[model samples]
Target chain A: MKLNDEEIALRAGELGPLRQWAIAHQIKVGDYLGARDFVAVGQAHIMADTESLGAAGVDWLERWAALPAEHRLVRIPTITDPRGTDFAHAAQLKQQPWMLDLERRAIAAFEALGVLMTDTCINYQTIMPPVRGEHMAYGDTGVVIYSNSVCGARSNFEGGPSALSAGLTGRTPRYGYHLDERRLATFLVELSWTPRELSDWGALGGVVGRLAGDYSQVPALLGLDRVPSADQLKHFGAALASFGSVALFHMVGVTPEAMRLEDVVPAGTSLKTHDVGEVDIRALQARYAKDVDAVDVVVFSAPQLSLVEIRTLAAMLDGRRATIPLFAVTSPQVKPDCDRMGLTARIEAAGGTVLSGMCFYQSYAREIAEANGWSRLATNSAKLTNILGGYGYRPVLLPMEQCVAAACAGGKLT
Target chain B: MSGEIYYAAAGMGRKVRAKALVASDGFSARYDLDRIRGVFSRPEHKLAGESYQGRVLVLDAAKGGVATAWMLHEMASRGVMPAALVLNRANPIMVQGAALADFTMISGFDVDITHAIPNGAEVEIDPTAQRPFIRVI
Candidate 1:
């Protein structure tokens, strides 16, 4: 990797140990990934939820946070992904005191490093949306896929550590999705059906993602009768990233880069095309719902709800009182607006909890499930379904309306 | 099989020898592991119910979320982690986590490392070699 003078100085320790460590870490990752040089990124989003970070990671961050502010502060705009727990609802969620203490410490550590606690996976909708052709270091898989595929920005799956390194240096190793050659579609998918509900869209994403198989392969969709709304694409992209570890995808005639099939696919390229239909989407959902007639809880999260999604959920829950616990998780940015618009009250009136600044899976999911005796879970998010299995939850994938009905009808699947 | 060796395209951390736990399944710390139990917890995973502690995990590809980047380091800090990770392909999260944890990892072999390595076989991994490799010892 070629280093500019500033990079050299940082490595040489003239820029203090924090940046020195950060640049060295970047260079190590860059050389391994075959990055020739660093690319200046416009922003960095870090996913440092306490669940992922653990005690060691938080201690590591605090070590840096104790350093001089000049040495530790980020060089560019750096934001956070969802935290481990929303403090206001921690007790209700049955989160232990230790978990809350860890979250507090992690938040303080991030704040000390001059990181903004955006606490959102829907930053593309709630915070600054990246423009086409822009470069960024985004941590959350949902954020990266939405920004890269929907917004036409460039990024790889920058995890928490790499994203923080980019934040410190204002640059990232130029490789993977940052290169134009890597942006071209590797596989093609012909959609025989267009989805309406967010869950179906997410189910479609899961199907396509399984076909894509890995981070390096990009899947371009061919038949979308209509352009998907931002919220629709949000669920699709989140599930795709979660299920496949895929970074970017293209939807022909819809997404910015793939305005046409030829735009994303190189000429004369005979791609292996897979046809996905309504049957495939239904199969994916059925696989999750198999043998689960009832659920202990219903959740709406993973990408974290946009204000539009919240409004839609609120409307669905009107005059409906939930017998089972239902959660509507949204970003902090949208929560205040949700409150002011009475959406929060409306959802709460229906016996659903409105959680902000935290996502379900990221918030020590296993412990919370054990604490609350929540074994079977129902959610509209495919991303959440894909994740909760290992955490000991039998997650049922359903549309939002059905999820609401289940919540109101004592967790019965009907 | 006593002295067979497989070269990798990329590697990091130091060399170590351990028993191989091989599977042709994708890996994700957050999705497939129970860190508290030191075993593969996800029922669908190929290595489900197997103890991964201190064993070299030979797997197909990296999968799922970016939490593995931090989970790797956290796992190492707890003294419960794989001896090394040998994969056919690696996503950025694995590389980033290995870098942060200073854990042994080597990926990108000409052949599928998972198939080349036999389960529970004694093996040696050298990530610092001119061409990093894992050998059946």
Candidate 2:
């Protein structure tokens, strides 16, 4: 990788050991991914949940945090993804004390390095949305996919370590989505039917994601009757990134990049085209709920709920009483608004719990499942269903109304 | 076939020799692993219920979330991790994770590496070579 004078200075330890280490790490990644040079990123979002960043990762952060403030502070605006636990609801989630302690240590270490504890995956919706053509280093696959596909910002799947390195150095390796040529559609997806509900949109994403297969392939959708809302795209992009390791996608007409199919797909280019209809989406959702007639818990998360999503959920729960645990997880930014609008009280009045700044699967899911003896999980999130299978949960993907109905019917599918 | 060698387009970390666990399935530390047991725990995974510790994981692609970036480091700290990873394709998360943990990983090949290498075969992965490769030995 070609380094400029500033990079050379950082490499030579003229800045500090922390910056030196950050640059070295970035160089290693750049060399591996065939990056020719470095690109300046406007912002960096780090995903450092204690569950992912075990003892060693936290210790690693603390070592840097112990450095002088001048040497350790992030060069660019850096924020965080949803943490492992919401401290206020830790006891309620049955997360062990050690887990909480680790979380606190990780938080302190990040704070020392000047990282904002935004604790959100919906940062594109809550925090500043990136403008088209802007480059960023973002963690959380959902954030990367949404920001790239929906917002037209450029980013790869910058993980926890890479995002922190970008924050420290204010730049990332210029490769992958940063290159314009890499953004073209490798696979073409034609939609035979459009989805109405968020869950259906997510199911559509899952179906399309299975076809996209990997990070390198970008799928361009050709048909959509109307423009879907941001929240709909949120679920779709999150599920797509989760099910597939895809970073960027073009929606032909909906997204910023591909205003027309020709914009992403050159004229006369032959691509592997897949046609997805209502049955394909329904089939994907049906596979998750196959033998499960009932569930122990119903959660709405994985991208965390937007304000509008929260309001819709609150409205659905207004007149119903839940017999099973139903969790509505939202971002910290949306939580305040939910409170101000009495959405929180309405959700709680229906015997549901509203968790803030924490996602279901990210929050020590396996441990919580064991603690609560919850094996059959129900959620409206296709992404959650795709994830919880490894955590020993039989997750059923349903619409928000059906999930609310299940919560009211003692976890029964009816 | 025992002495056959396959080269990778990109690689990092030291060379390692271990038994190969071949699968045509994708890998994600958070989505497909039970780190405590050091086994492929996802029921849908082809290597489900199989121990992955100290083996060369020759798999299809890197799939799913960013958690794998920190997970490789965490798994290495506990001494529960693959000896090396040889994949047909890799995502940034996998490359970043391998970089942080200093874990041996080589990806991008002329053919599907999973089919090239047999399961449980003794293999040597040399990432430091001018042209990184995995050899059946």
Candidate 3:
């Protein structure tokens, strides 16, 4: 990869050992991806929850943190994804002490390096939304997909190490979604029905994701009658990134890059087109619903709730009393607003816990499930449903209203 | 099957020989693995409940989450990792994970690599070759 004087200096250890390591890591990734050169990025978002990091990763960070402060500080504005535990609710979630210890260490390390502990997956909604064509090194799959597809920002699926490297280096390899030729539609998806609810939208995205199948295939979607809300797009993009490993999608007339199909689709290029309908979305939800009526818990998370989504939840739980635990996680930025507006109180009054700064799955989900005897889970998040199945839970994907209903009725779907 | 060989577009880490845990399903450390038990724990996955330790994983693509990029190195640190990863296609997350862990990985094949290699077949993956490949032995 071609490097400027600054990059050469960093690679040569003229900058500190930490930056030398960072540049080396970037070079390896750039070489593998065929990046011709490095491109300066505006910001970086890291997904380094304690569950993913484990003790080894935390210790590794601590090693870097031990370096002189000047050598380790990030050059650009760097933020974090949802942490593994919300300190306020760690005991309630039944996370082990060791997990908390590791989280604290990781947090301390990040702070030493000048990273903001935003602890959010929905940073696009809560933090600054990237402008069209803005370059970023974002770590969360949901963040990458949303920033790339809806916000028209350019980012690849930068993992924890890679994003941190970019944060330290202030640049990333120009490859994948950063390049124009790679952003063109590889597949065409025609929708017969636009979704009515968030879950339906997520199911639709899941169907598209499954069809796209790989990160390299970009899908161009059509047939939407109206514009969907930000929360709607959040669920759709998160599920698509989760189920398909896709980084970007173009909604023919919706997203910024695709004012029309022709804007993203090159002339004379033939694409494999598939049609998706209401039945397909229903089938995708039904696959998880199979013969399960009772759940141990109800959750509203994955991409943390927006203020509008919180308002909707508060309205649904106004007169209800939940017999099972219902967790409603939102960004730290939204949590204070929810509290000030009494949304949090209403949710808590209905036997629900409005968590902040942490996603449920990123927490020690399996361990908490074992502690709470929560195996049958109900949620409105298709991305969470797709993930929790591996963590030994039977996750049923339902709409927000239905999930609230289950929580109020002793976790019974009926 | 012993002499059959398949090539990959890119590769990393040292050559490895292990039994192939072949599946057409996608892989993600955060979504599909129980690293503590070294098994594919996701119920919907083709290799659910199967142990993946020290085996060569033949899968369709990398799916779900950015956590795998760190989890792979964590798993390798504990010495409970797959011998190598052979995929039909790989995402940036997988490549970054393999790079950090210094683990054997090869991806981008002409044919469906999962279908070409049978499950339980002893395979030798040479990622250091000028042309990286996996051969059924």
Interface RMSD of each: 0.6, 0.5, 0.6
What is the clash count of model 3?
A: 0
Against the native chain B, what TM-score does each candidate's chain B reach? 0.98, 0.99, 0.98
Candidate 3, chain A: TM-score?
A: 0.99
Kindly indicate the candidate among 2 and 3 with the higher lDDT: 2
Look at candidate 2 and tell me the lDDT of residue A385: 92
Tens digits of per-residue lDDT for model 1, A1-414? 999999999899887899999999999999899999999999999999988899999999999999998899998999999999989999999999999999999999999999999999999998899999999999999999999999999989999999999999999999999999999999999988999999999999899888877899999998889989999999999999988989999999889999989999878999999999999999999888889999999999998998999999999999889999999999999999999999999999999999999999999999999999999999999999999898888999999999999999999999
Candidate 2 residue-wise lDDT, A1-414, digit = tens: 999999999999898999999999999999999999999999999998998999999999999999999999998999999999888888988999999999999999999999999999999999999999999999999999999999999999999999999999999999999999999999989898999999999998899889988999999998899999999999999999999888988898889989988899898999999998999998998888899999999999998999898899889998899999989999999999999999999999999989999889999999999999999988889999999999989999999999999999999997
True contacts kept of 1: 0.74
Off by over 4 Å in 2: none
DockQ of candidate 3 (2 decimals): 0.89
Looking at model 2, residue A169 earns an lDDT score of: 92
Off by over 4 Å in 3: none
Candidate order by DockQ, decreasing, is 2, 3, 1
Against the true structure, what is model 2's DockQ? Answer: 0.92
The candidates' DockQ values read 0.86, 0.92, 0.89
lDDT of 3 at B14: 96
